[model samples]
Target: DQQVKQNSPSLSVQEGRISILNCDYTNSMFDYFLWYKKYPAEGPTFLISISSIKDKNEDGRFTVFLNKSAKHLSLHIVPSQPGDSAVYFCAASVIFSSGSARQLTFGSGTQLTVLP
Candidate 1:
């Protein structure tokens, strides 16, 4: 069973518009949620993140909202630009122990296309 799921395989948006991506997770132990953006032939880079204690987090044009009770999360991009076109992935991690590395579980991914 997948702990994290991105139901949408892709999304499209016009430049300077908003793009929304959704995610769902099955694990309650997840304390941290993250979004990553990846381009072809490159590694996924960190985008935004939210802690379980907070309902939302924002960084410039990107924002992430978490609803623990519903086990759902969404990422919003405001004024989406052409450069923002890429594969977006939702990831969740639980802290197993102090001083231990976090193991992240990632959703498949959602490809975002920004049309000019």
Candidate 2:
């Protein structure tokens, strides 16, 4: 079974509108959650992130909300622009032991299209 899941395959929004993407996880040990944006023929670029200890984190037009009790997280984009079109991925990671490397587990990803 997949630890992380993004139920929506795609999303579309007009320019200057809001776009919302949802994700769910089955792993309770995951403490770090992140959102990444990927373009064709390019690597995923980190967008926003939130720790399990915090309910919400925001940066400019992007925001990430995490609900530990529900094992869910959501990414919100305000004033969505055409350039924001890309595949959005939800990832979660946990440190297994002290000074251990973090291994990120990614969701399938949701394609977001922003119309001008």
Candidate 3:
């Protein structure tokens, strides 16, 4: 019973192309969605986020789309660069600790290799 899953463990795309990562969630209570990017040794950093009320959110070269009815979400990076090579995690949570630490539920992760 996976509450969240990233079926594709990896994705490779040429530089200046587009990279798309997908995620699925089974919990209907999830209200917040987020994507984090990670390098080899560094901790995962927030890349983008979307609220349950919206269907799409974008920042610079990154975009995230949500399909609530399908319990699916995707992160899209346009003009993907060699620097974009890293792992991506899709996390979902509804119960954020009020005045406390944020607890995140992360997907397995999808390694994106942006080749030059």
lDDT per prediction? 0.96, 0.95, 0.94
RMSD of each: 1.5, 1.3, 1.9
Model 2: weakest 10-residue lDDT segment is: 94-103
Clashes of 1: 0
The alpha-carbon lDDT assigned to residue 64 of candidate 2 equals 92
The count of residue-pair clashes in candidate 2 stands at 0
Q: Candidate 3 lDDT, tens digit per residue, 1-116?
A: 77899999999999999999999999888888999999998999999999999999999999999999999999999999999999999999777658365567889999999999
Scored by lDDT, model 3 comes in at: 0.94
How well does candidate 2 match the true structure, expressed as C-alpha RMSD? 1.3
Off by over 4 Å in 1: 96-99
> How well does each candidate superpose onto the true structure, as a TM-score?
0.95, 0.95, 0.93
Q: What is the descending lDDT order?
A: 1, 2, 3
lDDT of 3 at 93: 76
Task: Give one digit per residue, the lDDT tens place, for model 2 in 1-116.
Answer: 99999999999999999999999999998989999999999999999999899999999999998988899999999989999999999999987567578889999999999999
Error of 1 at 82 (Å): 0.7
- Model 3: residues >4 Å from true position, as ranges? 96-102
